[model samples]
Target: MKARIVAETLVKGITVNAIAARHGLRPTRISDWRRKAREGKLVLPADKNAVFAPVKLAVPAIAAPTPPVPVTTIDLLKGDVTIRLAGDTPAARIAEIVAAL
Candidate 1:
């Protein structure tokens, strides 16, 4: 009887709350069956008209490290003025130079 109720509740267009209310059972009981089904403990009867799709899984591959991009220099040009700077120059010094220009 419980399995029949569960099957009816699982049918298309049927809801657990509606089936529970109709059968005077708690919604939690119906939901428990659903949870069990999800965990492979409960198996619902297959419908004759049901269509299933094949699932494919790929084996996880090891990730390779990304090489760092090389930073060599910074060039600031304004009109006939050109400022050549190293990539390792301090940000505050760069800001001061920019502010002075």
Candidate 2:
């Protein structure tokens, strides 16, 4: 292929005449390919020296969720007096406390 022949010329020790001789092609043909590449018409492969490896991504571990803590304080104020009780105290008990105050 023209691309392969052109790529050969790009190698450090390889020459257009040598590549043309090896492929039984005219050196002028390879020159034309190079010209086309310079003019943005032909595409060339990556350089042999430029190597790459595939990348792998790892999955992260998930942690167990913690339980929520319950908030447990209620306050009642009458004049200058303050009363504190558990948030779960019954409404009837609160009414009795309020009436006693």
Candidate 3:
């Protein structure tokens, strides 16, 4: 019972390691108790003087944020020049543009 109390105190951020050691309990047990408390598994005593009280189990929920879309830019100077022959804008027209450039 004393060990549980000491562990609870440690969980509450109180420096009670010495007391826990005196009760023949490892600090890791106190750490586990604290973790259990956060998970709402450990119940603390209702009395103000009590070391621990009963707590409701709580599982934290996490949500991931949506990512943004990528933007692409086309730079004519850096782009490859392709000449295609079609009924409308034929290869001859492209040649004219390149000659003008």
| Strongest candidate by TM-score | 2
Clash numbers, per candidate:
0, 0, 7
List candidate 2 segments past 4 Å from native.
51-101
Residue pairs in collision within model 2: none
lDDT values of the candidates? 0.84, 0.89, 0.59
Per-residue C-alpha lDDT of model 3 across residues 1-101, encoded as one tens digit per residue: 63367345744555657656766777677767767766778765555565676899888787787775543432223246644344345457656766765
> For model 1, what is the C-alpha lDDT against the true structure?
0.84
What is the Cα-based lDDT of residue 25 in candidate 3?
77
lDDT (tens digit, per residue) of candidate 2 on 1-101: 88878988988998899999999999998899999998979988777688799999889888888876754977999989999999888889999999999
Residues 12-92 of candidate 1 have per-residue lDDT tens digits of 899999999998989999999878877877777766778999999999998998876766888888889999999888899
Candidate that would win on lDDT? 2
Full ranking by TM-score? 2, 1, 3
Q: Cα deviation in Å at residue 72, candidate 3?
A: 25
User: TM-score: which is higher, 2 or 3?
Assistant: 2
lDDT of 3 at 42: 79
